[model samples]
Target: MLSALRLGQIDRYLLGQLLAGLVASTGGLVALIWLTQSLRFIDLVVNRGLSLAVFLQLTGLLIPSFVAVILPITTYVVVQFTYQRLASDRELTVMRAAGLSAYALSRPAMMLALISVVTCFVLDVWVVPSASAAFREEQFRIRNRMAAFMLQDGVFTQVSDDMTVYVRRRDSDGTLHGVMIDDARQKNAHATILARRGRFLPSTDAPRVLLLDGTRQEIDHQTGRLNILTFAQNVIELSSNKSTAQRFRDATEMSLGELLHPDPAVVTARDRPKFVVEAHRRLTAPLTAASFAMVALVAVLRGAFQRHGGLLRPFIAVLVVVGLLAVGLMIANLAARVPALIPLIWVHAIAPGMVCAWMLFVPELRLGRLSSLIPGAAA
Candidate 1:
């Protein structure tokens, strides 16, 4: 009973240290990246007059995706840093001298890694896709609807790739004065319009602007002739950035089931491979937390401990982890090209964890023989 209680206490202490490191590393990275990424949408808040609440909601929707990317890396860092700290402080030495085996020493970190893996899995399977869908929906609404209402007086605002609108004045009653529009959506024709007064009209499919006392000057490309028309009132439809009139959710926004069993009618031919790739990526991504955590544990816990610190060991671990990440990315890209490579992605994710676990648990496995396989292992 005493031994079991002591083991429980040790596990709690180790888990707490790892959790602290995980929270700090993950929060700092997420905050830094969020600051840089939020700058991309600053124009929406500053120039487009979006409300603070709306801005916060829009940016907050991206947190799940960010967490998905940061979780695995942070788990690895937490394990590496916590174990290294314990070793450097002679805590690991004291524990080892107390007759704790390698597996006993690593049990808490392994359990923590398993927890991280499950968290990552939840984010990958559900939270990220739902959040991504919401983000895209909100973004489309802001770009297409809110931006139209943000039209400033005497400022040229681009509504779409082929449309630009300039308003000299906006009345309290929502009427526009001295409105000018440029429409070049057509390949063979370009039209420049000027109106004395105009008002925006709401439509479900396309947005329209009503202009009174307007003149439209159109230039025909084939004949190269300028045709001018004066009208008492005219309605102009603005082209949208989307190719199809209906908005289609991207693969990244689809649930795991939808990605795995995509509707052929809804999915285009070009997007089929992307869906397959995304499905495999989701399956493999969460397992990376386990793999990365194992790599950190094996790197630090193996071999003799230096009195000061094992700087070279951690450095080599970083290099190995970086190489693994590079290989994972490269494999993902290759899997997208040739479906045969898809299985390799799973291999890359699982093999490292298995290998590291063996090295950590098996007393027979020596770091010396593995030195030849890994360049800096001997060092």
Candidate 2:
């Protein structure tokens, strides 16, 4: 009962520490992301001809995606820092004297970890996917508007392969006079055609191009034959860089529920290992929050606080947690790619530090204590 009570109190303290740590950490991270993304926006606006409105809007929408990538790392860092502060202040020692085992103190960290897991799952499953879909949808919309840039007057417009067309003038009625076509690759090597006037027709489903009017002339260079072709109007295709469509997506966009319930046509044929691994990743990411919390707890119990530079050990603990999390993530990703060891992906994410949490629960592993479970700890 005493041990349970002691654990409960430490858990409360840890909770207090966690709340403060989360606000300071996530706030700073979000601000850093905004500043960096804004610089990228300026570059796109000045150099890539992106509109300020679109750039800013895209920047705002991109925050969720960034958060999805950085949230685990952020949680891990904060947890480590918070625990290290307690250790530095000798609060950990006080809690231990009150019959609290490291394991008991770890309850709060584990609770926080559990929360992290649920939060990460929601992000990967819902928030990130929706934001990504919106980002892609708006990108297509932006490209369509940008395609108008190709409508330059008095230039040879090559909209696609096998179509080269030139227009001398564009009338207000959307008519082009003195149309010249060098469509040699389209059919029988038609070298050039001169028209009195021409009109543009954009495909409703496809890209837009030009249609010639008046008279058309054709020549076969192989036979040195000049063929006079006359028509009321002729069709020519021009290429435009505007896309108003979305490409087919692979499995990365899917959530755990969707992946498990995938269509036979989508999931059957040739199985994709990346997607299978990603599904497992989604399942395991939530566990990472708890695992990160444990690591932080251990670091906190072992850390010391300096009277003058109080936050340094805590700060270093945060960095260490972040670094270890990054390494674990990288290992999991690489394991997912290897077909022979794909099943190891889950292990990579969750197994690395299982023993770290044990130190908190068992007193023997802690400093100046041995066999606390034995009748009289000293032999």
Candidate 3:
């Protein structure tokens, strides 16, 4: 039992090393994507004369979303790398000779996989959904206030070609009194309008504008004729702006509870397959950590080599893992088109489990003694 404990410790230590490397690499990749996406929004703010505060706040909110997306693949990668490295070294050979087998080494992986799956489940079902929604809503708020904030660079900003919007100044008072509108659209047509004060309200899908109360001077471009008129209140449309758009599907952003109990309307006829795929993928993400743990062991922890090709075994193991992932993705895509193929997710999740099981049962892969129970027990 003491010897068994020692073997388990060694296995765990090796696994930890692999897990660290995998998560780091995956996390780095995710961070890079996040930065790229953030830069896009940052550019938008810069062109619009918006401040840096909103920019940082918006990008910071996107981090958790990236974490959910990258965790699963990274978990698998680390395990595969860890196990193969042990196998390539005669360390595995020594352990096996001391009566440890593939199953023994994989025990650590199976246990860790369960932990990883749970983490993923919590991230997908809870953290990510809430963050995404909050981020989206905040964006809506920012766009709504975009015009108001435009008063930052100067007391006023000319948001439109013919309109000059001005604020006497900003203080706790929230007062905006703007004057001047130049209408020069048609040939030789021009108008200068003034207002006592104005209020800005954002339209859902058009130019952010303000309502003005004052007088107007109109000139007919055709004849250069001038006419003066007065008005109580007139709405002037500002420059058109677009809301932030992204490619992420609803499934990618929903919380676990939401996935399980999506609004019936949300699960509409056109997008059912996508939701199904996403829901199942979330539940199964954790399972793969365990499965990969085993497979990584099989690929890397098997075979007692005399020369110990340190990196070769790991590289080969990673290749196997990558191939399996590719197959899994292909199958998942096919399944999406045909839900009957939904079994593919299970297949991908379980393939590694089966491979690890095989390694546990086979003895030739490792130079090790058979346990006392083997049918052809060595005397």
Candidate 4:
């Protein structure tokens, strides 16, 4: 009973260390990735005049997706590091001498991997889909509707692909001074408008600007004659006639059911393979956490201890993991194109852990030395 209690205490200590290392490494990597990824949207804040809070809110929706992708990798890294440290400190040696088997020593890491698997499932199935939808919707709104309102004082702002607006000065009362617009929405009738003063109209569907004392100038396409018309007040729509209905949902923004049974109207036959691949990817991705943790355990705990601490096994394990990650990426890409190979994804996610677990545990069982495989059995 005393030995069992002591073993439990050691397991708790190991689990605590693994959990701490996982949190720190995961957080640091996530923050670094977020910084790099958020750079793609820095123009929204700098050029579009979006506030810092709004920028943070928009980019923050991406954290769940990032966590889901990196959790398995981080789990493997933490387990590998923690076990190697214990071994280098001769703590694993002490545990082995105390009659702790390989399974007993690896129990804490298995628990950690299980936790990661559960978290990854929750993120991939629920949190990521909703957050991705919201991010895309918000990005669309900012580009289409709110972009006109974000015009800077002196910089030319591309409100939409077909429209460019420039304002010389903007007042706190929402009045603009000296505005110019280059409208190319019409195929052959490109027009340039110059306004002495203007203000954006309150709108939700499409942005519009009301110009005062403005002149609309256009060159006739056929005759090449410049025609200028002066008006006291005119309303120019800032964005093209694009409605929210025109926005198509991406696979990342779809739930599992939606991916599996997509609307034929929205998803064409050519795109069906992509949807199927995404659904299967989400289902199988979480299983990789267990597989990766098992690989790390096989690296640190599988072989006999060297008096001088060998680096060959750990280095080989790292190479194997990198190779597996590359292969997984290739398989996902191939499956996306040729979905007949979808079973490869499931095999990729599950096979490594199964093989590693057998190598680590089943061989010991086959030796007919159950006493050596169980903690305190030799006693």
Candidate 5:
């Protein structure tokens, strides 16, 4: 009972340290990535008149995707750092002198890694799909419905592929001054209109721009003919829905069941392979945490102890982990092209972990005695 209590205490302490490192590394990486990516959306908040709360909601929905990608890497870092610290402090040496096996030393880190694996699975299976769907829906709304309101004073904003709108100044009463509109949606006829002032008329469907004292210049593509019309007032129709009626739903947004047996009506025959590969990828991705943690543990604990730290083993451990992840990604890509390669994903994810576990544990035990238990070995 006393030995068990001591072991429990040690495990708790090591688990705490591992958790701390995992949180810190994952949070910092996620924050760095978010900062860089969110710069692309700054126009939405500053120029598009989107509220800060809405901006945060849009950005926050992406956290699950980031966490899913970073969890395995962070798990490896936590295990490597925690075991290296224990070794550096001679705690591992003391434990070994006390007759604690490498398996015992690895238990805490393994537990932590298992927790990370479970968390990653949850994110990959459910949270990621739901968040991705919500993000696509919200983004579609912003691009199609609220684009006109995003126009900034003194800046030309491309509302869509073939349309650009510019405004010099927007008055307090919502009147726009020095407005310019270019409409090239038609393949043959293109129009550029310059107006002294304009206001957005209230409409239920399409965007209506009421221009005052404007000159409309229409150019014919077939002939080098330009038709110019001077108007006192003109109302131009703008697209309210720039994107197609189809909502964007990628394989990443599908549930595991849906991805495995995708509806033929919803997913085309050519795209079925992509969905199947994604489902397999999600299933295999979480196992990388355990594989990575085992790699870190074996790197530190399996080798002979040195009075001075050696960089070779730790560097090799990092390379091994990187190779595993790279192989897994490459195999996933190939699996997307050829469904027969799907089994390789599991092999890439889990084989390293089994090998590392054997390297860490088998050397410490009497394999000769275990082999002697075989019926044919005695004969």
Candidate 6:
């Protein structure tokens, strides 16, 4: 009973270390990645005068996807590093001397691997998809419906490729003193308008401006004659041609069920394979964490211990993981092209872990069996 309790205490200590290392390493990498990724959206802050809070909120939605992508790799890294440290410190030797088997020593790492696998599943299946959709929707709103907010005093803002709006002065009350618009959205009937005053109207789909006491001037292409019309009030929509139409949903924004059973009208035959591949990718991707953990265990726990620590096995494990990542990418690409090959994604995700687990633990099990078969082995 005392020996069992001691073994449990050791397991807890090992598990605590693995958990702490995994969290610290994962967080640092995620922050670094977030900084680099957020650079792409710096224009919103520099050019559009977006607030820091809003900018962070807009970019923060991407965190879930980032975590999902890096969790498996980080799991492998943390496990490999922790076990290597243990071996170098001769703690693993002490555990082995205490009659702990390979499986017993690996229990904490396997537990951590299981935790990582569950986390990856939750992020990939639900959190990432929801966050991706929200991110795209927020981005769409910024580009289309927020054109009115982009306007500034004494500056000509290009609301769209063919439209420009200039405000002579803007008041604190959201009123424009003098407004001018150059509209060329129509190929044949390009119009320019001058307004005495204007105010932006709230809209969900596009930005709308209501002008008071405005004069519209346009030249007729057919007659080659310029026409001018004066009006008390006029409403003009400031939206790009793309914004006027419906936004198409990408694979990242879709739930697994939606990806698997997509609307035939919305999804083309060419895109069906891509959707299927994405669905399967999300399902199988989390499994790689367990496989990667096994690889790390095999690297540190398998083979004979040298009196002098050697880096060769750890280096080889790193190379093997890199090769596996490359192969996984290649398989995903190939499967996307050939739908029949989708099964390869599951095989790639699962086969490595199974092989590594067998390599690491089967010999120990064989030895136990042979010893049990011999007389007086139980004693």
Best by TM-score: 4
State, as a TM-score between 0 and 1, how close model 1 is to the true structure.
Answer: 0.90
Q: Ten consecutive residues with minimal summed lDDT in candidate 3?
A: 240-249
**Candidate 4 colliding pairs, count:** 0
Worst 10 residues of 1 by lDDT: 370-379
Q: What's the TM for model 4?
A: 0.92
For lDDT, candidate 1 versus 3, the one ahead is 1
What TM value does model 2 have?
0.66
Can you tell me which runs of candidate 5 are displaced by over 4 Å? 152-156, 167-169, 177-180, 188-198, 201-244, 367-379
Question: Global lDDT of each model?
Answer: 0.83, 0.63, 0.65, 0.90, 0.84, 0.89
True-structure lDDT of candidate 1:
0.83
TM-score of each: 0.90, 0.66, 0.69, 0.92, 0.86, 0.91
Which residue pairs show backbone clashes in model 1?
Answer: none
Ranking of predictions according to lDDT: 4, 6, 5, 1, 3, 2
lDDT of 4 by residue, 1-379 (tens): 6777787798899999999999999999999999999998898778667789989999999999999999999999999999999999999998988778888889999999999999999999999999999998888777667656578889898877788899999999989999999998887889999999998898876778899999999999899999999999999888875643478899999999999998899999899989999999999999999999999999999989876677998898899888889999999899889888999999999999999999899977887768756766654
Error of 3 at 36 (Å): 2.8
lDDT of 5 by residue, 79-139 (tens): 9988898898899998878656677678889999899999999999999999998988787
Task: Report clash pairs, candidate 3.
Answer: 84-300, 117-286, 125-256, 188-221, 189-221
Measured on C-alpha atoms, candidate 5 has an lDDT of 0.84
lDDT of 3: 0.65
**Displacement of the residue 66 alpha carbon in candidate 1, Å:** 0.7
> Tens-digit lDDT track for model 3 on 1-379?
5665566577668667756776687779888988898877875487666668868778878887677666666766766655556656666677767765566656656656666778777877778777778787776656545655566424456544444556554455544555555544433445677777665664563344444568878876667778878888787655332332332336766765566566676667556676777777777666776776666666565665546455665666678767876887787677678988887798788777776677666564454445522422332
| TM-score result, candidate 5 | 0.86
Candidate 2 lDDT tens digits, 1-379: 4444544565677887786777678778887988886785575477546878888787777777666666667677777766666665777667676655555566666666777677778887788767767776665555444322344478886634555667788888877777776665546655577778766565443434455455566666677777887676666544332232345555666776666566666666345556666677767766666666666666666433344435554566567666766776776667556756665656755764576656555545555454443323322
